[model samples]
Target: MTDFQAIGASRKTANTMELIASAARRTVKAAIPAVPGGIIRTGRNAWRSGKASKVAFLVDGAAYFSALDQALRQARQTIWIVGWDFNPDIRLRPKQSSETLGELLLSLADENPALQIRILVWGMGPVYSGKSLRLFRESGFSSHPQITMRFDLRHPLRGCHHQKLVSIDDSLGLLGGIDLTARRWDEPDHRVSNPVRRSPDGTPYEPVHDMQSMVSGQAASLIGDVARRRWKKATGQKIEPSPVRDAAWPLAVAAEMTDATAAIALTEPGLIGKRGHYEAFRLTRDAIRAARKHIYIETQYLASFGVARELAKRLKEIEGPEIAVLVTKSSHGLIEKLTMGNNRDRLIRRLKRIDRYDRLRVMYAVVPDERGGEKEIVIHSKLMIVDDAFIRIGSSNLNNRSEGLDTECDLAIEAETEGHRQAITALRHRLIAEHLDAAPEDVRQMESEKRSLLETIEVLNCRERGLRHFAVDIAHGGTTPLPGTAIVDPRRPYWPLHRLRLRVGRLVSVFF
Candidate 1:
């Protein structure tokens, strides 16, 4: 019986490998119609405008809550939210209202007779355990006539809905790492020592630092399409196009901008039930491959072996562009630090080996205080800027779980014109400025002093070490020495238990 089982396992492995090979060949042969040069040139022309199509940023919990309230109020026809976790009992504005998310959603449904609300959440995770699912059912969302909520179980046995986005009436959208849950609220100040935070039950919660973005125009419409498709997949219902009506929300268009083009990128496994469309991941690879000057990447995790290999390949070419990566240092809670922090170490080791020119540098963002104490500001923003001509912001992290196991959505804008390029550059400076609590102009001046924007801030902030810096150093320094390969070898004897734990972790990562 054992011999028979061994033979069966070997056959299964061979079959899987053959399937993967076939998929690869099909992907290579697939024809992605070339985007016309005229369109590309038009986008290039729009880069001259020194303004983004639409710009809004959300920091901490207050910002997230405010953005959600404003989006719901402004939505005329539809409201769609996708999340890794969704707690109906959590209040959007605990300080102002005692109503939980469920009540608030029901109220929206009651008020907007013509509006449709759809909520998609991860189906198999701690957040969606049996009891939690019961809570969801007990919440008004399950019975609300105008609201539709469903658990997204699209992937194999272990996969998750990890995107956090809210689209309103096809006119406005919010995307980033911020989730609508408890313990996610805090002010931009990120008062570390302060003991004042409001939870849904009026209990105090700890402060957290995070970021999200609000967008409008064509970009919003594109994101809405993504939401609609996912909704259909989960609920088997097609969304009727509901044109945007309310104009009260701030939606700005660049005045002097010219020739700017924006596109959305998504990432998923190679094959999904037949016809191929890993367009998002492919676009990301192509963007990296095409970079001529520099690439600035910001993500929550950096554990994708495939991405690391691609980066190493680019770095090895010598003539390729410089690459800079910004990730969270180790200050996460015990469990998170053990899992994500361990992956960070493995990633750093892989990067070090591939960095032949010493051009690649990884750093953590720190939030400093007046008296010299600092804290590691968690980098929840998923952003990548290439040569000031392209920028991407969304919920996708740079981890194996994100790439192959979980669902994600990202927004990308290419500024081909000088004005648009300048606008994007200014936005990048603004993000850096907010992180440093410095004026935008000050951040801009510091930009030229160092090789990368992250380094510039680190140098300028040398004198202002506080809880933030201490946390960053401690977190980054504590990781075991990196291994040599882009792909972590769980079998290696010297590899830390954390690394081995990650191998065990793969079982659940599909739903993480």
Candidate 2:
């Protein structure tokens, strides 16, 4: 099983809305894998599983953006974009064209009167806009009649709306961690300096690494359904699901896995007469527990205590699966260093201390620079693969907030055939190869020879542009976690909405 926006660009058409689902459904308190223990199951870890005719994984920002732009250019009916952040000014193909994201959508709307473009992002845009340089396009988005944007004030508490998805015409889906914002476009090479990688304002940022998956058929429609529900809740308007009549898969990209069933898991905090759900968290834990050989993870954060506890237990087991975690080691600014960085370091220390079997390896990626040195590439992807048995890709960070505080969604695929298993293993190997600058077949052969993931990596790692294992005493991130960790990385909702409603009503009666 697999587990898994900021703000208004313009205030003219910008409005904030509360997230209150119609019903107060009780939380499904099922254990990891439920009773009999399987990877993907509804009412347990996954909300639903839909069929996919073709699944293609875009490895980096360049591939993903290009394919997305291509798909958006071909859209016919509806466009749904749900993210933690969004920027209408950023260019999808900066080198090839100067058309910004806003212009593209507006142009699409102009082309087809039936087409509707809707974007929903987290309401707390100003909180992250400054640090992340999220563009606030005043004249953008709302300039067109068919293009609309809204802020989703999800949960009555300190939770976030963090799902990242883009669906077109209910036939093609682009689901991943990479948001359509500034400072996120980069090729697989991830050069230390690229003029074309600059933001809309000519500000150069560090190289970024992320992934997105393209799926066609019923699975893509399922993703559209997710976007529709969130849109309806945030804007209080129901949008009909488009029929999968068109061939919507991007023609430039090739599918890696065919005829696969994908499980869509979600995490929603308990609020507004609605019960909390942690299907993403449960799916992740179950996937980890189900691993028999190896577990490879790429995450932006590593501060979830529940996840850490399960990983620690697995590492302590003599015959447990080997784990390899790839994280970013760079400059995210002072605030991040003080908060998320410290929490991550604390978990890193614990994981290191408990990895008795030496089965765990935590590392960062780097690319060769022109100055004869290596510069680390930012790792912002949330991916996990368990010994080719399953693969997951989505927006859920391995942090406390992502477990239940935020609204999260993920797509997981379980290998049901020999070919599926091989494809899963191939993807893992391909990612490793990308990091190490080695060929996928070479990585596969090395692992085959070594019979261990750690050994294979050690054999492939080089002095330049390769993965660097984290030292026992890593720097920058403090050794001890800072105080008020819960404030910054909360694991649950801050306030129950029903309680807030009761208090508000009492106040109104007294005053009015």
Candidate 3:
């Protein structure tokens, strides 16, 4: 009996120790900022004309990896890759078929000897864990010379490392919606006949539309700093500063200003460790407040608690600028369509209540020519164009997760000069033009005619069903219990008590 009591006491003590350790780990992780300090700022006339920094745009996985490969090949010192997901098996250039990302990093480490490669990826669900996690662990454990990979699990409940960014040697940086993985491959032409793609098995995957940015000068350095801080939080290691080079890209850079100025915006839950990063939400709020003419946005989801309120207020103010939003018609999965989609519709109705359904327009991107008969084109790019001057791109969806429940990093550039503003406007035109399979000039002409983006889309949508109608149907296709209110906490039990709570929450979300 005494031995049994001793054993039970020992077990309790061990459990207490384990809990303490877990709490300590969480505390350390929470200390890390969802949006690092000195990353973003908002002000009146932020986009006013002046001599400012030069910015470039790089989109999708292929373009980003290509730019990284080039920058790494030329790097004199450091490389940083931050992402929600990173696949080691993914060949940066699968068409080249010469090297995988891991091999490339290994070779870089071997050749440079002094160069450091830091990879920060989300510590997502175990089911999503792939070869990258294993390779990262093995490399660290085996004491592989120069490459370092760390998993970011900073936010305990709702946070995720959703930023997709890469700074190469501190000289060049890439930012945007594209993650380094399969199923993300589309060209500027957006051809349907024969598109480039790669499957998990290295076969042909379907085409996807996405965007990214390539930045040089101080912007690159800024991104490098952001990456370093995230790395430190993840691994408790300090990174040395990497300086930028003066080399120029042959292609024209977007947001090329005469002045060297820009800002970085971050998004996550409300609080680090306690909640998530809401940096994106904060940035959007500030941007909306500052807008003078028009606020154009492209995002995956638009169902945030704070954001919806802000939009309603702005739309009702009557003094604020008009707003246009672009989002996916529906999530790819039916379950998401049922849950998230329903929530989105409720949010939309709320926005309409404020704007009286006039100052707001929401549209979805559709593959203009679906010769292959694909039912829908998934809209994945998270971007915003405000007053034809401010541009933002990142991984944050405009939802609860982005507001205060998930990790996200976004880049924002204000076109301070006419040339820079025009360039940014042209890029927006180009993106819309690509989706519509029309020329940029045509898009510009349509916009000049004072057509809502949805109206322009309707005109361009070749299908007899039409774009606006399609968007409406897609937005409406969900179980109408309450839109944007179903909170699925998978950890809960399958008992009737839990189901009752869920049903109650569903009903309450609709009214609240």
lDDT by residue (1-512, candidate 1, tens digit) is 33223433554454445554644454342223223332122222121112224656565567777667756766668888888777676767666777777787788788879878888776654254334656555745676778876766554334456778888887777787877765677777666555446555566644456667676666666667778887775555688666663434543322323333456555443223343234445545656765666788778776556677667656654445677677777544664555567666665666655444445656666655557766666666677777787776677777655654456766666766687788777776766666666667877787776645545555444434212321232223433424432233121112343345334434433432
Off by over 4 Å in 1: 1-61, 91-100, 125-134, 137-141, 194-207, 243-248, 251-260, 269-272, 314-322, 331-339, 354-356, 368-374, 449-455, 463-512
TM-score for all models, in order of appearance = 0.73, 0.87, 0.75
TM-score of 3: 0.75
Which stretches of model 3 miss by more than 4 angstroms? Answer: 1-52, 96-98, 129-143, 189-195, 203-206, 243-260, 268-277, 314-322, 332-335, 353-357, 368-374, 451-455, 463-486, 489-512
Better of 2 and 3 by lDDT: 2
Tens digits of per-residue lDDT, candidate 3, 1-512, equal 33223433554454445554654554454333333332235432121111224566665556666666666666657778898887755666666666776677777778887777777777662236545436535653225667666666544343356788888766577778888765666565544444345555656644456788777767767777778877765555687786535434424233444454556666533321233334466777766656656777777776665667766656654335677677777665665676567667767766654443245666665553556444345567888887677787777677666654455677777665687788777887777676666788987888788555544554555542222322233224332335325354121122444345434433432321
Ranking by TM-score: 2, 3, 1
lDDT of 3: 0.60
* Span of ten consecutive residues with least summed lDDT in model 1: 42-51
Q: Candidate 1 lDDT (Cα, whole model)? A: 0.60
Model 2 regions more than 4 Å off: 1-37, 130-140, 474-482, 496-512
* lDDT ranking, best first: 2, 3, 1
